[model samples]
Structure formats: C-alpha cells, structure tokens
Target: MREKLLGLVALDRLPHACVLESGTAEERMALAKDLAKALVCKSGVDRPCNTCDACRKADSGNHPDILYVGPENGRKTISVETVRNMRDNAYVLPNEADRKVYIIDPADTMQDYAQNALLKILEEPPTYATFLLLCTTKASLLPTVLSRTAVYSLSPVVGADQSDGQLEEAKGLAAELAKALASGSETSLLAATSAFEKKYELLPLVLEQLGLILRDALVAGSGGEQMISGAGKSAGSLSARYSNAQLLTMVEAVEDITTALALHANKNLTLSRLVSRLAAGM
Candidate 1:
C-alpha cells in the first residue's frame, strides 16, 4: 500500500477520489492525512515531506484547503444537509494549496440521501478537488459511488485499538482457507468452511480476509508483494499457482460473497458456491 501510494506520488497519477477500507479508525485517519498532505505538497517529489509547510499544516489538521466532513453532534449518520454543503463547497477555489481535498471519515456512515447527494460531486468533481472516502463497510455504499472511486482495503494497523477480536480470529481461519483453496486442498477447504457453522456471523470477516489475500497475490504477481502484510505466505503461494486474471476473479468472488453475506444471503449455499468457484478457478 505504501509502495503504491509512493508510486502515485512519484508519477502524479493520484486519483480524484479514493476509498480507504480499513477497520481501524486511527490508521484510516493517518493515511488520509498523509495522502492529503502529499497531494498539496509543494515539492511533490516524495509524498508528505515533513519539512514542507503544507505537510506541517496537514499534520496540524488546520489546512484551509484540506477539509474533513463527518457525522456531527453524536449523530449515527452523516446528514444530507452536510453533503449538500460539501457539494456546494467543492466548487470553491482552494485557499492556499493548488488543490482542495475533502476527507470523509467513515463514509459508510452517510445515509442513502447523503450518499446520493455526494455522488454528484464525485462524478464531476472540480479539476482542483479531490475526495477521500474512509469506510469500514463498503457494502453499505452505493455502487455508483464505489465505481467512481479507487478502492484500497487495509488490514487493521498493528497495536491500534482492535476491539473486534472475533473478526481477527476469523481472518486467521480465512487465511488458512485461502491457502487451501489456492492449493486445491479439498479436505482442508471443507474443514475450514465447516468451522463457519459454529460462527456463520464471521462469514463477512472470512470473505474480507480472502479478498485481501487474493489482492495481495495479484499484487505479488504484478510485482508488488512488499505491499502485502499478514497474508504473505498465502499470497506468495497463490501468486505462483494462479495468473493475475485468475487471482482477480477470486478477489471479486470473495467480495461478492462478502456483500451477499452482508445482505443476509443463505450461508450454506454461499459457502458452497464460494468453495466451488475457488476450486474451479484453480
């Protein structure tokens, strides 16, 4: 992830909008700030040069052109009115930097109306504007919003506040399953899926772990293995066994299964179909 971001900074090919999928709020915010700072940096050679004034301002969270929008007043969701204001403000000229960057923390917190309202600006954002949508659950977001943005999923940052212990455990099991699926270990795959019977609720976490594992494998196949963490063995093995296209298919399959589970799809059937697809792909 750092390598990809650094390459973007080097090539000045950063997307107009991006989705950072991360469970840890602290990691999300830190990445957002780093990306924002890099976008507005004067030197522009290496991202977020700590010595730069723009980087300093971003570190202080007071950059006039670097704005943050989120749910307010203990509200559970972001209001449409706030999105409306953001749409209006997006057209405004940057105060100091060459670009205006807006970071929306937990963008999945936006209600349907708010998400719809924000979609307009995302589609035809101002030339000098950029948007960063931080989210834990991509399933809650509109496909339109997702299609118009670059999506990057990250694992929980080490030592950060990790309250979801079950999810972590699920990921461990999922990692083993992913390796088994890639290696065509039918017995292991069946056994792993059987574990889901005792805790079907962790299906989402399992699917997410599989997606991340496949993503890393594809990256490794494409020469970015250094970007992967926690799933390096599975990624390395999968990359050697599958082509990039095949890895991508598995990633999409995992994401689809995850979204289906999130929407209350049949667990047994989904698990069966998922394993079938994984097996067939290999």
Candidate 2:
C-alpha cells in the first residue's frame, strides 16, 4: 500500500481527497501520519525520507503544512465550524512544503452538515492541497462525499509480532461467533466462545470484534464495504440470512453487552444473556 501511495507521489498524481478505511483507529492514524510525511518530504528520491528535515518535523508533530482535525473538546462529532475552517484554509498556499495535508482521523464521525461543508472544498480543491480522511467505515459518509474521493480499505493487524496465521484465526473466530448468533445456532456459539470471554481485561476487545461483524453484515447487505477484518464470507452469509433490522438488533445486543462489561458487570451472566438476546433476534 505504501509503495502504491508513494508511487503516486513520485508521479505527482496524488488525489485531492483520499479516504482510507481501516478496522482499527490506531492503524488509520499511523497510516495518515506516514502519508502526511510523504506529502511534505522534500527529498528528490525515496519520498518521505525519514532523515529529511520535513520528515523529522512531521515525526515530531510540528510540521506547518500538515493539519490534524477531529472532534473538539468533549464533542462526539466534528463540528460544522471545523469543516468551514478547513474549507477556508485549504485555499491558502502551503507554508513551506510542496503540498498542504489535512489529516482527519475517524472521518466516519463527521456530522452531515460538516460533511456537506467539506464536500464543496473536495470538489474543487486547490492544487497545493491534499486531504486524507481516515475512517473505520465508508458507509457513514454521504454518497456525494465519497464520490469525490479515492477510497482505500486497509487490512487489520493484531500486532507487529503476531503471525499472519494467528491474525486470520482471530478474525475467523469472530466471524463464526457472528454467524452463529445470526443463525441462532446455540451449539455453534458455545463452541466459538473462548475462555478469554470471561476475562474482564479481554472483554472489550472481544465485544468490539463481534460488533464489527454485525456492522459489516449490515454494510454488506446494503452493498457497501465491510470494515471488519477477514469477515467477508461471514458478512455475506449474515447479510443473506437476515434483514437490516435483524442485523441492527444483533449489533445493539453486542453493544449493550459491551457496555455491561465496561460497567464491571458479571461476565458469565452478561455473555449468556447476550447470546440469548442474539438468538431471539435471529
């Protein structure tokens, strides 16, 4: 992915509005930072050369040409005012770098009006401006907003040291868990549940995977891209077996169970009840 993106940089063919989606927020931000470095790097060869002053400043988070925009203090969504500000700033010339990069992490959280404000600029961006929007899912944004951008879907990574087999195994487990719940197969669900389900420290991660499965199912049913890793087959199956409402109910059950887990509720009971609710929904 880096090679392709950097190749675009080398060819001077970077898109004005690019949307990259990933299953995890951390990966999106990390990739956004790397892309920002490439946009601002001054090296004639191996763009985004980490040793260059531009790359060093980008690493240090003080690059003048790069901007980070997201939710304001205590806010859930990116405000329209923020989008408006970006619209005005995008027209200005870069401070020093050849291109000015705006990085918006978790772009799925942008409010409707905020997205509208951005759509205008995206349609007619300045030659020196580049916008990188990192999101977990593209379904949340308007079709008009997505039409003007180049979209990229990133695969999930558990850890640097984790092998590909282990990562695929984890995604397969999550897919099976979601498929069983949607199919109302209690036996399948029981077999898929791991002992880690009972560990409070691991509950959040477990629930997040389940939630992603259901959300991806909905996205698949609607002909949108899925954000969950290695769950494409399961998502296809669930989308065929369930309606939008059913998928939403399953997602809500998983979310509720997650909230219960976060509140320090009994894991055994909560997990059991969550399964029951999911089966009933199915």
Candidate 3:
C-alpha cells in the first residue's frame, strides 16, 4: 500500500495535492509524515532515507519546507485563522527543499468557513507546492475542495479477525443470520443462539475481524446475524432472546462505539459497555 501511494506521489511529477483517508487518524498521520519526508529527501529516492539530513529533519518535524495545519491548543476543529496562515506560508519559496509540503490533519474537523478559506489556495496553488488533506469524513468536505485533490480511502484491514480455520464456520454463521433476519420464527432465533455457541466459543483478541463480519452482515441486510458479530459461544447460546431489529440496533450501537474508540475515547469502558449492551439487547 505504501508503494502504491508512493507511486501516486511521483517525484518525477514534481508536485501535486492529494487527500488520503485511512481507517484510523494515527495511521493517516503516519502516512502523511512519510510522504513529507519523501518529498524533501535530498537523495530524491522513492522513500526518504532516514540517514540523510533532510530526512532526519522531516522525521523530527523540523523541516522548513513542510508545514502542518491542525487545531491550535488541542482544539477539536481547525480555525479559519489557521487556514489563512497556511495560505500565507504557501506563497513563500522553499527554505531548504525542492518543494513545499502542506499536510492538513483531521481535515474533516475543519469548520465550513475554514474549508472555504482553503479553497482559494487549492484552486491556484503555488508552483512546486503540494497539499495533502487527511480526513475520515469524506461526505462532509466541500465538493469543490474534493474536486481539486486526488482522493484515496484506506480500507479496514481484512482478516484482522482471529478465526482458526473458521472461514467455513463463519459462512455458516452468515447463512444462519441471514435466515433469522428473513424470518421472525422462533426456530431462527434458536438457531442464532446455537451459532453463537458453536462459532465464537472463544472471542478473538482483536475484535476488528468480528466487527467487519458484522458490517458485512449489515451490508447484506442480515440484521439478525449482525447482533452476534461479537458474541462468543456463551452469548450465542441464548441468541433466541433477541429480535432481529433489536440485534441490528445492538450492532449499530457497537459500530458507534468503534468510531468513538478510533477518536481516542476511553476504550476499556466503551468496549465493556458495548458488550454489556449487546448482551442486554439480546
């Protein structure tokens, strides 16, 4: 994936602006920093060689040519004043590198006025200047801003779930969830309970895989099955207790918690509450 993105930001091309989205803000920031290093590397290699002086400065956030625009005072949103400052810096010649790189983090958190303020610079960006916007809220961005920049979405890592030769069993679980969702029959509910017991007997350390399965179920419209996305055998055994709608609501609630966790919310309590909610909803 890094190689693919490096190709997109081709050094041969001199300069360009882009927006890269990732599953987590941390991952997005890491990618942006690496790209900044690559842009200013004196060696002009595909990636920055950390041994080089330019690379070291960039790694330390001391690179004169790389500017960052983010919330001041750890605020949640970037202000229009910050955007104005970024625009002023955009016109200046590179201090120590061939190109100037601007990275905007949590671009989605920028207020409407701030985004509009950024539009003028994006429309007629300085020569050899590059802008990269890292955001998770693609829908919230101004359409004009999106139109000027190349956009890329980083998908949630697949197979991040822990299942030991359980793909077949998972498929079976999918079918069961699908059936339960289709019919409000008592047998369907009982089957869901049984599936929870058989498939997720021991929960995986990483819940992402299970979460993905639940998301897939939602996409497939199998609401009944989605409720059991995080359930272990202990919980699955009583799946019959939940209605299809109730299970779906539980899944949605969990997804909301997942979003909160990604934003650096209290993970332990949030997860425990999500689990408890799922159990209760069922």
Candidate 4:
C-alpha cells in the first residue's frame, strides 16, 4: 500500500488529470483521498506529509479548494445538478491554495447526461485546477471524458497459492475479482460474484488457497517465518500463539480487505490498519 501511495504521488506531480480505478470501494476512496492530499499538500514532497495544514484540511474534509461529489440522498447516481454545481464552482479561483482540487467519488455513478455535462470541463479544464475522477471501472466513464483523463488501473495483489501445483484458475480469478470488487457499483459486485461462482468449479481448492494466505499472514504476523517463498514454504517453526479460530478470523478480515480492495475502498486506512492488526495479534 505504501508502494502504491508513493507511485500515485509521483503520478500526481505530472500535469495531467487522473482517473484512478480500483477494485473495491475502500481502495478507490483511499486512492481518491490520497490523490486529493497530494494535490493540495504544501509539503511539496512525493507523498503528502499528512502533517501540514493543507494535508490536515484535506484530511478533515474542509479544504476550501477541494470539492467532493458523490451519490446524493437515495439516488445512486450523481445528479446533473451536482455536475453543474461543479462546473459553476470550478470557475471560482482557489480560496486557500494554489490548486483547486475536485474529486468526484464513484464517478462511474454519474448519469449519462451528467457525465456528458462534466465532459466539457475535462475537455478543457482551466489552469490551476485539478480533477480526480474515482471509479471502479473505466468502461463506465464516457469515452470523451476518459480520453481526456489519464487512467491508472489499480489491480489486486495476485500470486500463487500456498501449496501445490500452480492454480492458474485462481490467478485468473483473482484478477477478475479484483476488477469487479474495485468497481464502485454494488450491482457490479453481485454480478461478478455470481459469474465467478459459475465459471470457477474449483471452489474448495480456492478456499484452500485462501486458508494458505491466512497461514502465511499469520506466520508473517508473528515474524516466525523469515520470508514467504512465493506460494509454499519449505519448513519452519509454527507460531502457536494464535488459535485456529483467531487465524481464521484474521483471514476473514483479509478477505474483507480483498473485497474492499475491489470496491475501491479506503486503502491507507484499511490496508495499513489491516497490517497493523496482524502485527498486533502477533
């Protein structure tokens, strides 16, 4: 996650608009916030220091220069009116900072007309303005808008299973699941889960791999294991501090992060905290 944060900050340095796509809601939201902080930050570092006034304001959700829009009320889609508000508000110069940052969270939820309206601004955004569109999939965005923005696809962490011959299916499924989970729409998750269930006949083995991932996480948690050897380990002393149930619960949390990662959920808070929890248990 630190690696991702650094890379994103570097990308922010470039004078270009970005459409950050994540697999889970948590990951997407986290990425969006990170980008916003980077944009408005006064630290002038690769990543937002999270200590400066600009970073604090952004983190506190009151940065005058930063505008966040998302699904309003019961409506799943961001209204045309909201986009208009963005269009109108964007013209105003920054109040507190050099750059005005507009973050459209779950940008994919914008209705077609709203997206079309937003397209004009991205087509020729004013100077001193930065736009960050957060989405789970680039396909949901208008091509016109997409063409004008730099798209960075944040993929799930995929690797071999803990034991056995290579599970090619798991790897492929992991990629697909990552994309679906990152997608901001709930409908996408339901559809993807269903599709994954239908296409992959190796549920038990996949579950086993998940179990292995948990074990590695546990071993890694206690610092009992020197290093993870790709999928399987040779032989090592087992960390007996945690019970089977606790280990299982930890795995469940990891799976939650997995889902969150897919949905573009908050990455720094979720991923970093997850690691922290594992280390704590150790």
Model 1 RMSD vs true structure? 7.8
Task: Name the best candidate (by TM-score).
Answer: 1
TM-score of each: 0.57, 0.55, 0.54, 0.53
1-282, model 3: which lDDT tens digit per residue?
Answer: 344355334323323778888668888888888888878888643346567899999988899999988999878899999999999989999999988999998899888899999999999998878888999857768898888887766653345353444544554554454344435454554555454443343222123334433333432342222232343332343234444466556555545664565566654565455445545444
Number of colliding residue pairs in each model? 0, 0, 2, 24
Cα lDDT of model 2 by residue, 3-28, tens digit: 44554564355688889886578877
What is the C-alpha local distance difference test score of each model? Answer: 0.77, 0.75, 0.63, 0.61
Which of the two candidates, 2 or 4, achieves a greater TM-score against the reference? 2
Clashing pairs in 1: none
- lDDT for each residue of candidate 4 in 143-185, tens digit (9 for 90 to 100): 8888798776676334435322436665444333333323334
Off by over 4 Å in 2: 156-282
Model 1 per-residue lDDT tens digits across residues 68-187: 999888898889999999999999999999989999987999988899999899989999998999998677789989989988777644444442686578678878787787767777
Specify the poorest-scoring 10-residue window by lDDT in model 2: 2-11
Top model number, lDDT: 1
Candidate 2 colliding pairs, count = 0
TM accuracy, model 4 = 0.53
